[model samples]
Target chain A: MRKPKLSDEDYPTTGHEWDGIREYDKPMPRWWLWTFYATILFALVYVVFYPAIPLVNGATPGVLGWSTRADLAAEVEAVSLRNADIDQRLLDTPIGDLGADPDLTRYATAGGAAVFRTYCSQCHGAGAQGAKGYPNLQDDDWLWGGDLEAIVLTLKHGIRDDGDDDTRFSQMPAFGDILETGEIDALTQYVLSLSGQDHDADLAAAGPVLFEENCASCHGETGLGEREQGAPNLTDAIWLFGGDAETIGHTITFSRYGMMPAWNTRISEAQIKQVAFYVHQLGGGE
Target chain B: MTDQITEPPRLFEAREPVFPQRISGWYRRLKWRIMLGTLAIYYLTPWIRWDRGANLPDQAVLIDLAHARFYFFWIEIWPHEFYVVAGLLIMAGLGLFLFTAALGRVWCGYACPQTVWTDLFILVERWVEGDRNARIRLLRSPWTLRTARLRATKWTLWLLIALATGGAWVFYFADAPTLLADLVTFRAPFVAYATIGVLTATTFVFGGFLREQVCTYMCPWPRIQAAMMDEDSLTVAYRDWRGEPRGKKHENTSGDCIDCMACVNVCPQGIDIRDGQQVECITCALCIDACDTMMEKIGKPRGLIDYVALSDEPLERAGHPPRSIWSHVLRLRNFIYFGLWTGIGAMLVVALFIRSDFSLAVTPDRNPQFVKLSDGTIRNAYTLKINNQTGFARDFHISIKTDEPLRVDLEGTAELNVTVPPDGVLNTRVYIFAKPEFEANRAETTPVRFWVEERAEAGARTHADTVFTGDTQ
Candidate 1:
């Protein structure tokens, strides 16, 4: 051994001085050096056991062959298996009696809320509050029906869906080709007055007779609407298209055809049932 | 000092083994009692059980990290109520400070696990290898079969103690009986085994081998105590004035100290008490016991090595009476620390007792804010989490108290009645509908209170205030 120890003045330094300040170049502790070497060894071993190096196309597959994607898939599969019993229960439960089982009701509603946000929210609004032309699902008024079974049917076949043979289909002839401009104007005023909107009383005088002859078959004589025929109620403040006279005139001249795609073709049966259950419980189901 | 000495100091100083001579005195007996008392408390605490009904664990003291709860006898702390645990930690710290300022390192000398466990390890060592002189001689002697057998016996005993210490710690985190059964069957969690392994290694190395070095180098409490101490703080110190001017035994010249090394030999720290107060001294007062015994044998007075404040040194040297211990202990700083320590404990107790058995959190739906109904009624949806912390399943009736003619209803149930399980949280939705053209229906948002009342208790009720959104926005 050269020497046991050296005093501070004779200790080795980094050799770069600044303003009479010199840093000591002390040897690292044996334990600390060994820990550093162990860390490097661990990295090397980890690279061989896990995907570590990045390639142009993808990461290099290690011998163990584990991936985060596969891990996530396994977790999802595990959860699916865990809830298989509950999912079966939800499927077997009658749509109308769902409310009787609080557990299934909660499961359906919570699941339906997720399905709604993912698919139905774009058209019907996130809370099923509806946009301009779409029907407000949270209201008691329903063009088709608002009950659980009715909602399920609407979800399965949809309103005016062309692909589904059992789709709720209805059509009103565009009055612009059949009626005079003066008659259509009178009908517009009368339609607005039915909803208690401001209108010219004199122009609306011919509306009741004209509506009874032309619109009373699907729309009731009192204009309360026929749910079996899939017609809307006119007395309510909830308007699907618009309640203004201009929109009403346009509706009379060129009739409205709202299209809702059959959800059964798009989403799973459980998802369809859940979304229906979700809409029914939004304080609107009769 | 290094320049004057011909021999140079090594960069890495090799450790010299400490073999404290076995001695008995008032301090030694007190340490033994404290060690036994503390060890019994540690090893036996997990076996205590208290009933917490069907829904909760019955362990009297458990951290229950899986459930994010702390159960201690009658009180259970929820994750949100972690401030109570923080308050307890603060009280413990302040208590340490108060004791250090008054009596000096009482925690370190008598109560610290390191001190207690190391004392036990040393006792085992003494039994296996004889007393201090014999152990020193064995160290210098060449290895032999008998020596190997003694070493093996001592090490095996130390390992058993270390294993027990580690096993005791794991019991605090889980149910003791169930975990113990699982551990014996080798079905315990990997983390539990890993924790035991790590703790066992640390306890063995720290308590068995590096005993005084831990206090002198690793522990920060003794260094922090330097700031807490003053002239009036009672520390284990030597009255060098009376005992210095050293003379050989029976050839005593002028001082009481006969140059006997009884105080040093019996010291756990292996530090001479006559060298005055040092950081290495745990102030265990073992040296006082050893020196006092020697004094009686030689027909001299005891307390040559005694507990005294630095300020009392001058007064005692002049032959005047030393001040009372109360004068040294009851200072303004110590009283303030004690007041703070007790105040937090009192506040935590009050908080625990006054905590509600049921709680509510109402979150209004942010998706659509408000939905206008067919009859022009404005509706707002809310999700309420009702936490029933009690042991019984509870029925809570939901009602809205508002000036907006708002009607509250629970979805899927017309009666607005909800049953929450014991010690469970119920996540359910609520629908509030306002009358057509109500005053608040014209406004953007209206304030509303959701009252959830337990049906069992006539007056037990809680309310969560939230806003009912309207059509204006």
Candidate 2:
């Protein structure tokens, strides 16, 4: 850019001189002056075309007829259209059948992950890492059986729950009244020994007879509880109540009966099956 | 060095008219970029869309005040979670303080709305009426048809920008596209138009007309900033030690300064930096830019006008220059501020973690403590208000437990299965009646527990407790 010459007509001279310093009052460029005018014209056009002046009653709607709500609605409609195919497919196919289709399975898994975060994360931690007293689905152990069919049944019919008829009906008898305190203690030791924990040799020996007479019906000969009856396996390291001697003694004396809530009345069977398959896929199902 | 110092140089200078001559430099470019960036974001953010399923607005950023909902991308904020907004404001304040302590007035100079809009308006003026010199000359010129047209055109552009600025602001409050349409069709709500008008007037007045006067006089930031600044704070400064004993170039050999008044001429705020730091100075470095260009032309050092804190100060006892001011920014005051800021942030996060999903309140019917029913049963009335804070609608079953065999009788619905809309409050009047035998055995006042259980699919349940009061036996 060439510097314009400072002429007396175009430049206004500053009279103040400090150490021979002076300023020229030069006129601004005409192009710059026109741009300012252009901006004003644009503003007027904008006000006339869009919402601008506020009347006593309300704002004056411009001629362009644009609105934020309409824009948002249009955007939402576009997104909904994009997801329409997958959403329709989800509705058409049974949740169980979704497992067979890889694309559907992927979609369901992602959808399940989001649902799990919103609904299941409170009790079962965000990562499905169960806290104390809550069952960890990541492991192979299942109190109500791990098979897809069995899981679906168990979810639909909660254990010992009065609300649903399909509930898994299994209640450990209160041995507190049946067995003597010493006998209960001996059986507790035997149960602990089944998991390979240290136990009193004499007590374990006596517990074998007690186990055969009272517990073997459900626990089986080797103390590996029957899954059909919702009886827990005794050979595994994992314990529902506790593995400690005191806890084992208490379990035998009181007879622990943890309840799994019935979902038939709350959640549909399809949903239960979907959740069951999801839990089975957690990698621990037998 | 041998010259004896009589009195220390005065800390302040008498006010002098700046008359800054405009010049272009790196700092000026940086300011322009920032101003443009901020303006684009402000005007365009309302148009961005986010998918929020059905029955939800898709605007990326929106504040649905009518429904008490705030949408920011994927996160949805409810009125109950207003604490999040409060926490954010606190965080912003602390962040500003920290930034100010480190680089004095950087936010004011580069990022403040006032600075950005004013710069835009100034650009518009420069484009229309020419630069500072041209504008000054035009002001002195006699009134003519061309001059009037130019002036009118400039005002028109300023007004349009102001209107747009105001219009964009209301979009945040409602759905932008629909409101725009409503605005055009003349069907938009009155409040929307009123808000836009107010904003437009303010933008035009503050950004176009008042301009520098707002920053120099009206704004409270200058007063607060004075206290925030320390000697070590990095600020736009003229190196008096180098530029003093000023004289024009090719005339007298004294100091690096050419006595060109370029720095004063270019200043938007019209403040002279050579007169020492003033409260009116926004530290925009425009003056530094003006002086640097003058230095380049005069073959003097560029830093004759530069950003300097107290790093150049000499240690009185040690006889060496003390540590740079930057190191002091990380010292006790800043550390304490940081600690409090983090502490509050952590507390807010913890509070969010512990926040309950359901809120419930129980109020006993004051009219009749206990009514003797026709069937020989005593009845107590209660109003249970339940707040469902979840995203989906929920059905909550209400049950009452007391010493007596009391049965809950909901006034309207037989089943106490109340359906509470998402983020909504549901109020139900419940009547508890006791069998004659049970009521006869009870004391004058009976303690009862009101329980609300949300039975969700997958067996997920949430329970809240309140109390149902009954008259004494």
Candidate 3:
């Protein structure tokens, strides 16, 4: 090591001084200066290899041609490749027997939740509870059925979806086209009476006869509904749409035909199964 | 002395090397024992075995990062219970404060890892290069084959010690024996090697090269000691009142101090203690031993350089007896710190004993508060998270308590009993349905609580409260 340097008083000072006090003209540490230079060199190298500088059109595509979007795509592609076997296994297994492997059920349920959020939440709900025209999935009332196989079939080919030839096709004729206004009004009261809702008994007296003649084939004699025909059980507290007197009157007059898109066209077969697993575990699965 | 202080650049300066001469004294022996005890504990703690079930780790002290758990013998801390760790850290800080207020800079001198490791490194240096005089001679001399050989031998030993220091640390985070085999076979995780590499480099540099400079310029504790120390605090100081009028031991009118430079020569800090309470003094008491030995040789009383408080200096100058060490230690500041330290410790112990082996959390679905089902019944969906934070796989019977007749159903099973692996967290959906008769008269919001009870221990139960929204219009 060098001998101790000249005293602080003897050392050269910057011209700036306060009273008799003077600041020493000490240079920065050599390592610090070297590190600063290294950072500058790194920045220059980074500009050449990475998309750093922004232009009006977009960022400059450096020689490496790396982009964050491309990077994310690669990462997603890598994960997809890794889970190919798991996805295949989930698709191969029957939906009813998924719970035989609890671990695989868990994986399917978790991945299904992510898929539901991305693809199904818009129409049904984030919680899988359907909105106004859509069905409340958490209830025991299913348009067709609530079992795993039934739900999976419904998911593949949605209700009254025109695009899918094998979709759950059902249509209630508009009573205004076939029946008189007074007859339609009487049928509404009887339909409301079936669920034990408030109704005019005198007007509803003709409901059983009218229901038998027009709606019994699909809605059943007791108005319990036919799942094979996608007719909702009128006696249930849960309703796909509103269950008020006005809504019931309108349903009789105009009929209801709700539409849900076939998910098979939009999501993968494995994703469909995963979402079925997730929805099946949402406390309402049969 | 003030003028001798240099104004080095804020963070960097040319370090002055210190070659502390070899000495033997009561304090040096005590320091040696303490150093050995601390180092032994640090290196061997991971290897100690505690039977915490076969499924869990057997290491007495382990930080299971993968599982996010901290295990210390019989005690286990989940990540959620990190406040206990925080409380321990606060206790450690308070302990340093109490000791510093009572006896200044004692931690820096005796127990600081920097001090202990540097002492060990210096001991190695002495064995290879002789004591202070010989090391200085080698430093001043031109390069020689013997010097090269000795330097290589010394550095090789230092590096080995540093590697061991780092190797011991990695074991704390994993199963020690398993990790050790994996490490030697180069099959260990990348993080373990990275941690060992970083720690090895830091230990080698900080202990071998920096030495006393760490205490003097690098450590923030030395500066913070100003607030901790007071006039009553005992510090290593030269008794200038007795030692003044300094002259040669042969002189007729000389003070007790011989001006022999033994105190200065033996100082690990390379500072003269006679310079009236310098900050560099770690109060290690090596100088007191050196000066006392010289004093006895010169037919004078010991303690020419001694541990004395400034307040006692004036009384001692008037030829009064010094007060007891307890008188300084049992003051108000120390009492407050000690009280706080024990209070937190007591609270932690109470909390640890009172804590249950499991935890429960319930979150109801917000999107649809209630669902009206087919049977004129109202239903609510909830997600329950049950944490089985124990060493053994356990069964938990999950049930609900409410004023209304609410039927609870777990998704996967007919019954509510679930088996959770040791230290596992189970998340499942639960459906709560109101009785059909009570559906019409249900309240807007009914308060309900879900309880998770250990099957083996009936009293071991935890509960979380939530609301059940009305599905009836």
lDDT of 2 by residue, B297-407 (tens): 877768777777755544522346446565767877677768878888998778777776676777876534554432335556677888876666888788776765677
Clashes of each: 0, 45, 0
Ranking the candidates on TM-score from highest down gives: 3, 1, 2
Candidate 3's C-alpha runs over 4 A off are A1-74, A173-184, A254-256, B1-13, B245-247, B250-258, B439-441, B456-464
Query: What is the per-residue lDDT of model 3 for residues A1-286, given as tens digits with 9 covering 90 to 100?
Result: 4255455466656767899867777554445455679999999999999999999999888999999899999999999999888778887888877889976888798899999899889988998889987887777788888888888888899887889998988899888889998998899999989898889999999989999999999989999999999998888777777888888878878888788889998898888888888887776788
Task: Write model 1 residue lDDT over B1-473, tens digit each, in one string.
Answer: 24444444333444556789988999999999999999999999888999999888888999999878788889888887899989989998998889888988888889999999999999999999999999988888999998899899999999999998999899999999999999989999999899999999988988888888889867998999887888888888887888887788668578888887888888888677786777889988888899889889988888888889888888998999899999988889988998899899899989998999889999998867877777778878899999988778999998989985667778745698999998788988898888765877878888999999988757599999999887773
What is the alpha-carbon lDDT of model 1 when measured against the actual structure? 0.86
Worst 10 residues of 3 chain A by lDDT: A1-10
Q: Which residues of candidate 2, in runs, are more than 4 Å off?
A: A1-286, B1-22, B251-253, B310-322, B349-358, B364-380, B389-391, B400-406, B412-414, B433-451
Error of 3 at A243 (Å): 1.1
Q: In model 2, how many backbone clashes occur? A: 45
> Cα RMSD (Å) per model?
4.9, 22.2, 3.9
Q: Order the candidates by DockQ, highest first.
A: 3, 1, 2
**lDDT of every predicted structure (CA atoms):** 0.86, 0.74, 0.86
